[model samples]
Target chain A: MNWLIDFFGNAANWSGSDGIPTRILEHLEFSAAAFLIAAVIAAPLGLLIGHTGRGAFIVVVSANAARALPTLGLLVLVVLLIGVGTVLPVLIPLVVLAVPPILVNTYEGVRGVDADLRDAAYGMGLRGRQVLFKVLTPSALPLILLGLRLSAIQVVSTASVAAFVGLGGLGRFIIDGLATKTYSDVIGGAVLIALLALAVQLGFTLLNRVVVSPGVRQVR
Target chain B: MNDEPLVRWDWIARNWDNGGPSAIKTLLESHVVMALLPVVFGLLIALPLGVACARWRWLYQPTAGLMNVVYSLPSLVLFSIFLSVTGLTQSTVIIPLTFFTLAVLIPAVVDGLGSVPEHVRQSAVAMGFRPLRRLLQVELPVAVPVVLGGLRVATVSSISLVSVGALIGQGGLGNLFIDGWQRQFYTPIVVGIVLIVLLAVLSDGLLVLAQRLLTPWSRARRRTA
Candidate 1:
């Protein structure tokens, strides 16, 4: 406990390249980059599959297969394959980890929307595009956002692996500290990562409240 | 970027022994032990807790909230925290992994029990079934499919995650990743990834088979529906 206090209270720990703030920034950078790429790849694909109800079996089965992939194994293998000369090694596995939840959630969300709602939109003479965008997207927003939130949090938690590959992140503290037998640094890094995850969870909860329609927000 | 080939069958054959702690076979045994124990323990704990939450309703939200926070914490972080008390043992890995399984399984149990139709409960009672008998013979068996759904997720994730235990020196096949990384040897890393993913898939397949065997009625109902 004293060591934890000392670890946090040190002014030296607060600034510079190896400082807590800098490590946090690196962690967030990795997480955000991976998350954005995963969303771009998965969200639209999930929506289309959900709307058309085609190829969903393949999409979902692949996603589940992807889920069973070990994150640490993937991270190390990628680094070994690509060389850690670029962030791509770190980002590749993080993106892979982040994609399945968003894809599955978004697919389930859109597909789960009531059949009556889709018919009503189509009955209004709306185009397929309008029906998907206006009716399904909004209706599916909660689960879509749930998927995104799950992906975002997962990416944040996993972004620590960047440090294992000699990149910069809070995980550097844990890995470095463990190597040096510095328990305080390991605990400090773990604490910071946990706090960041909680903040992400809260942020999504707030986002859910603000963006989800009043009627749908209460459904969960 | 040395000239080492991506994988060496010779290395694998040489290292795979039950003789030493560093042997791939030993690491694999420990990995299986570390991974499976948590799901078994978590299921044991979560069943009653989940039933209580489902029966009480009010307990569900807080329990779920706590579990979500637990789930959000990185496996590495959890491993480190447990290091203080468990001190670099398999228990350190198993304990946190159990929390993770609980986070997923509790919800599955709650939802599974909740899925039992009200009319089903009434019919069970009307059939003069005791509360214990009604729960075990009626509600739980019906909940098997949904509970198995959650169990599959828990099982696969657990198998994959046990590798992360390597940082604290408890990572089963995860040790291969660290060994490969430190030595810049691709063989162990490739082998580790292949084995861990294989383990996850095989375990998941077993669970799916268990679900099919346990809940034969579920498939029949789905077909009719």
Candidate 2:
């Protein structure tokens, strides 16, 4: 009971040198950068393979293989190679982690599209590109968005690994607190991470609701 | 690329003599020991909790929701929290890993129980079987495959996650990998990766075999001589 009182009373001590505000912003920035970069790279590749229906197995296998890499191991390797303190250590593994969900979702989404709708688009003399843009992509958007939601959540959680290499984020609090045996500081960091994960999950859930077609909602 | 020199293998060859093999053996044994307790402990706690949650409507949403939140947090963050509270030691690693396994195991159990056929529950009720009896005899048997599938995933996930414990100085195969990274010794890192991958595959295969053995009635039987 006294420990709780002391913890709350000394909350300011838990703030650390960069302070809460800067740390929060840095965490958000790192998450956003990793999510966006992974989405940009993976979404198109997924769409292409998904639409063509030729490389589905290859894409899935590659993505799964990438995911199997121990993220901390990869991060340590990257830090060793590039020297720590840059965003690359965080970004590289995050991209690797984020890609599998997007790629799998994209492939599932495109393949899940109605074949009859695709045939009708083809019969209308649309070029392959037009068919893809007009028919496949719109149909696949809802699922792709689902993938993005998952990717966003994963990237946000994984960005915590950045603290190991001295990159700034909410993880800094947790890591430093652990080293010093500061329970309140560790809890504060964990609370922040838990809250951040919930926020991302909620944010994406809203996005999913908005972007998902009414037809899909009806099916649900 | 051909003449670029392979750094990973060279390091392994140099280190094999100086307690490296024993270190590797200890690492493997410790990982299995660490992972085994949580999995067993989690299953023990979670199975009943899950069954209770399934039988009672009021407990379902809150219990499942709590587990989901725990599941979503990265293992590293959880380990850090545990370390701060408990101080760095084996318990620090064990407690968090166990908690994380609970997060997975509870849901899998609940989902498995939920997947049991409605008719089975109905029949059990008609026969006036007690809740415990119904669960033990009917629901659990029906749910075993799905639950086992979840356990397989949890086991694989735990193996991967246990590597992070190395960061806090708890030795495992991850220590090998991390040591390599710290000293720029590529060989042990490569070896660690290979070993981890092989472990994952072997564990997954064994789990699948276990599942098949346990749920022989669920799968189509092969024609035999």
Winning candidate number (DockQ): 1
Which residue pairs come into collision in candidate 1?
A: B165-B171, B166-B171
Tell me the tens digit of each residue's lDDT in model 1 across B133-174: 998999999999889889988988899889888988899999
Q: What is the lDDT of residue B127 in candidate 2?
A: 99
- Regions of candidate 2 where Cα sits further than 4 Å from its true position: A1-17, A47-52, A59-67, A82-85, A109-146, A177-187, B1-22, B117-134, B218-225
**What TM-score does chain A of model 1 get?**
0.96
lDDT of each: 0.89, 0.75
TM-score of each: 0.97, 0.80
Per-residue lDDT of candidate 2, residues B1-225 (tens digit): 123232556555565555754466667778777766777888898898888888786998898778766766777767766765676677777777788788878878888988988888999999998988888988898888878877766776677667777766663677876677656655566666666667766877898898888877766555331
Q: Candidates' DockQ values? A: 0.76, 0.37
lDDT of 2 by residue, A72-153 (tens): 6666666666666567766887788888888888888888888998899999999999998888887888888878877887
Query: What TM-score, to 2 decimal places, does chain A of model 2 have?
Result: 0.89
- Name the 10 consecutive residues with the lowest summed lDDT in model 1 chain B: B192-201
Stretches of candidate 1 exceeding 4 Å from the true structure? B219-225
